[model samples]
Target: MAEFDLIERYFTFEYDFTQASNGSANNKSSQKNKKPKVVKGIGDDCAIFEIPEKYQLVTSTDTLVDGVHFFSDLEPELIAHKALAANVSDLAAMGAKPLAFTLSISLPEVNQDWLKSFSEGLKNASKLFKVPLVGGDTTQGPLNINITAYGSVKKGRLLERNNAEVGDDIWVTGYLGEAAAALELYDKALVQKAALNHSEAELWKALTQPIPPLKFARKLTKLSRCGLDISDGLTADLGHILSKSQCGAKVCVESLPVSEALVNFVGLEQARQYALNGGDDYQLCFTASSKHRNKILNLAERCQINVTRIGKVQDEGLQLNLNGQPFESNRVSWQHFNQ
Candidate 1:
C-alpha cells in the first residue's frame, strides 16, 4: 500500500483539527470536555500543538529495531504495544500527563494482517494510556518502530534524577526482572505455548506486556523529585540517579522486588541477579525523603500500585547488602552500542 493510503486506512482519527485549532467546538460542553491541545495535526507537513499556558511539555522518542529489540517472529500487535509503551514510560518517569504521540514505523513489507494487528495494538494502547495518536510516518524498509510521546506537567512539578538527597529512601514501583527472564527463557524455547508451565506462561505474558506506572508516577510528583524508569535494571538505573544527584546508595539485596514467577523459574539467587542487572522492566525507580515513607505507602495503596523500598541514598557510593552483610556483584545491565 502507498504510505498515505496506509495511514488513512489504519491510523485515521476522529480529531477535527480545524475545530480544535480555532477553539470553536460546536458547543461549550464539547469544548470543555475535550479541549484539544493540537492546533494542526496529521495531513500537514508539520504537526502544530498549543501547549497549555501554564504547563510545560515533556516528550521522548524510543525506537525498537527488528532483531535487537524483539524477535522478528513475534506478533506485530505486541511489537506495536511495546514500542509505544516504552516512550510513554519515559514520560511517566518525569511525572507528566500523556498528551499525544506520533508513530514512525519502517516495515519490511506491507502485510495486511500485520498492519491490521499493529494498528489495533497502537489504538488499544493509546486509549489505555489516555494518550492520543496525532501523526507519524510509515515507510518501506527494515522493520523498525519509533514512537515519540508528548506529555504535560504543571509548572515546578517535573521530577528529576538529580534531586535525590543523601538521606532519601529509594523505592521501585511494581515488580522487576520478569521481562528479562521472559526474554532469556523465550530465546531458549523454554516458554513454548504447547508445553508451558504456570510460571513460564506468566513470564511469557510479562515479555509481551509492559505497563508503565503513569498515574502512580503522577501521584509521586508531589512526593519525590529524584526518579527514573527502570529500563536498564535496578542497580544500573539507580546509578544514574545517584550519579546525577552526586551521591551514593545502599541497596539491600533481599529487598529487591522479584515476582513469584521469576523466583519459581530461576530460584532466589538467579532471580536477584536478574533483578539487579536485567532490563526492560519499565518500573519507576525513585528517591524521596524518609519522612515521606508513610505518605508514599499510602499513596501507593490508594493508586493500587505496588511500591517497594529496596534501598536508601547515601553520601558516597553504591553499596549492596545481603542478610545485613556486605555484598557485591559482577553483573551489569543491558548496554546499547557497547560493541
Candidate 2:
C-alpha cells in the first residue's frame, strides 16, 4: 500500500482525550489534571501541541526492532502495544502527565491485516494512557517501531535519577522479574502458550501488556523526584540513580518484592537473580525521605498497587544484604552496544 493511503486507511483518526480513563487506571486523585491540549494533529505539515501554563514539557523516545526487542512472529497487536507502552513507561518514570506521542514505523511490507491489528493496538494503548497520537511517519524498511512520547509536569516537579538522597528509603511498585522470566521461558522453549499454567499466564501479561504505574508515579511526584522506571534490572537501573545522585544504596535482598510465578518457574535463588537482573518490569522505583513512609503506603493504597520498601540510600558504596550477609556481584544490565 502507498504510505499516505496506508495512513489514511489505518492510522488517521480524531482522538477524544476527554473520554479516556485517567492516567491512573485504578483510582483518580483529586489533583489529576485534564487531558493535555492538542492544537493540531495528523494530515498537517507539522503537528502542534500545547500544555497549560506553568508546566514544563518532557519528551522520551524508544525504538523496537524485530529479533532484538521481540520475536518477529509475535502478533502485530502485541508489537504495537509494547512499542507505545515502552515510551509511556519513560514518561511515567519522569512523573509527567501524558500529553501526546508520535510514531515512526517502518515495515518490510504493508499487510492489510497486520496494519489493522497494529492500528487497533495503538488505539487501545492511546486511550488507556489518555495520550493522543498527533503525527508520525510510515515507511518501508526493516520492521521497526519508533515512538516519541510527550508529557508535561508542573515546574520543578520532574522526577529523575539524580535526586535520591542519603537516608532516604528506596521503594518499588508492583512485582518484578516476571516479565524477564516469561521471556526466558519463551526463548528457551521451556513452555508453550497453550500449556501455560495460571502463574505463567501472569508472567506472559507482565512480558506483554506491562502497565506503567503512572497513577502511583503521579502521587510520588508530589512527594519526591528521585524516581525512575525499571527497564533494566534493579541492580543496573538503581546503579544509574546511585551514580547520578553521587551516593550509594544498601538493599535488603530478602525485601525485593517478586511474584510467586517467577519462583515457581525459576526457583527462589534464580528468581532473586531475575528480580535483580531482569529487565522490562516497567515498574517504578523511587526514593523519599524516611518520614514519608506512612504517606507512601497510603498513596500505594490509593493507587491500588503494591509498593515495597526494599532498601535505604547510603553513602559511598553499593551493598546488597541477604540474611545478614553481603550479596550481589558485578552486575550487567541490558545494553545495546556492549552486548
Candidate 3:
C-alpha cells in the first residue's frame, strides 16, 4: 500500500480537534474532567497543542530497530506495543500524563497482515493511556519504529534526576530483571527449556509488553523529589541519578525485588545479577525523604503498585551491601554503544 493510504487506513482515528483545541467538549462530563487540547493533528504538517496554563510539556522519543531492539521474527503487534511503550515509559519517569504521540515506521515491504496487527496493538495502547496518535511518517527501509510521545505536568512538579538528596530513601516500583532474564533465555536458546514451567513465557510477556508505572510515577511526583524509569537496569540507571545528583547510594541486595519467575528460571544469585544489570524492565526507581515513608507506602497501597525501599542516598559512590557486608559484582546494565 502507498504511504498516505496506509496511514489513513491504519493510523488515522476520529478526533474532534476543533472542540479539543478550544478546550470545549459537548459532553458535560468531559468538560468537567480536564483534558489537554489538541489544536491540530494528523492532517497538519505539524501537530499543534495548547498546553493548559500552569502545565509544562514533557516529550520523549524512542526508536526500535529490528534485530537490535527485538527479534526480527517477533509478532508485529508486540513490536508496535513495545515501540510505543518504551517512549511512554520515559513520560512515566517524568511523572507526566501522556497526551499524544507520533509514529514513524520504515518497512521493507507492505504486509497487510502485519500492518493490521501492528495498528491494532498501537491503537490498544493509545486507548489504554488515553493518548491520541497525532502524526508521523512511513518510509521504505529496514524495519524501524520510532515514537515521540508528549505529556504534561504542572509547572514545578516535574521530577528530575539531579534532585536526589543525601540521606534520601531510594525506591523501585514492581519487579525487575524478568525482561533481561527473558533475553538471556532467548539468547541461549533455553527458552523452550525454561518455558517447560511457563517461567520463560511470563518473562517473554514482560519483555514484549512492559507496563509503565504511569499512575505510580504521577503519584510519586507529589511524594518524591527525584526519580527515573529503570530501563537500563538498577545499577546503571540508579547510577545516573547519583551521578546527576552528585551523591552515592548504598543498596541492600536482599531488598531487591526479584520476581519468582526469574528466580525459578535462573536461581536467586543469577537473578540478582539480572535484576542489577538486566535492562528493559521499565519500572520506576526514585528517591524521597525518609519523612515521606508512610505517605509513599499509602500512595503505593492506593495505586495498587508494589513500591520497595532498596537503598539510601549517600555522599560518595554506589555500593551494594548484603546483610551489612559489601556485595561484589562487575555486571553493568545494558548500554547501546558499549554493548
Residue lDDT tens for model 2, 1-339:
788999888888677644433345344452255344666778788888755456788999988889888776877787788888899899999999888899998888888998999899898988889888888999999988899999888888889999999999999999988888888657433335767778888898889888899878876888887999999888888999999999999999899998888888888888888888788899989999988999999999998999999999999688999977999644466878876
Q: lDDT per prediction?
A: 0.85, 0.85, 0.86
Residue-wise C-alpha lDDT for candidate 1, range 1-339, written one tens digit per residue = 888999999987656545534345576655554433766667787777776456788899988888788776787778778888888899999998887899898888889998899889888888789777889888889988888998888778888899999888999998888888887667445335657788987887777778899998988999988799999888889999988989999999999989999999999888888889888888899999998999999999998988999998889899999988998776689889871
The per-residue C-alpha lDDT of model 2 at residue 103 equals 91
Clash count for candidate 1 is 0
What TM-score, computed on C-alpha atoms, does each candidate reach?
0.92, 0.92, 0.92
Error of 2 at 112 (Å): 1.0
Question: In candidate 3, what are the lDDT values of residues 1-339, reduced to their tens digit?
Answer: 788999999999777666544335576655555556677889989998877566889899988878889876777778888888898899999999888899998889999998999999898888777788999999999988899999998878888999999999999999989998887656543334443457777888899899898988887888886988999889999999999999999999989999889999899998888888888999999999999999999999998988899999999799999889999875788888888
With candidate 1 superimposed using the best TM-score fit, by how many Å does residue 252's alpha carbon deviate from the native?
0.7
* Error at 310, model 2, angstroms: 0.6
Comparing 1 and 3 on TM-score, the stronger one: 3
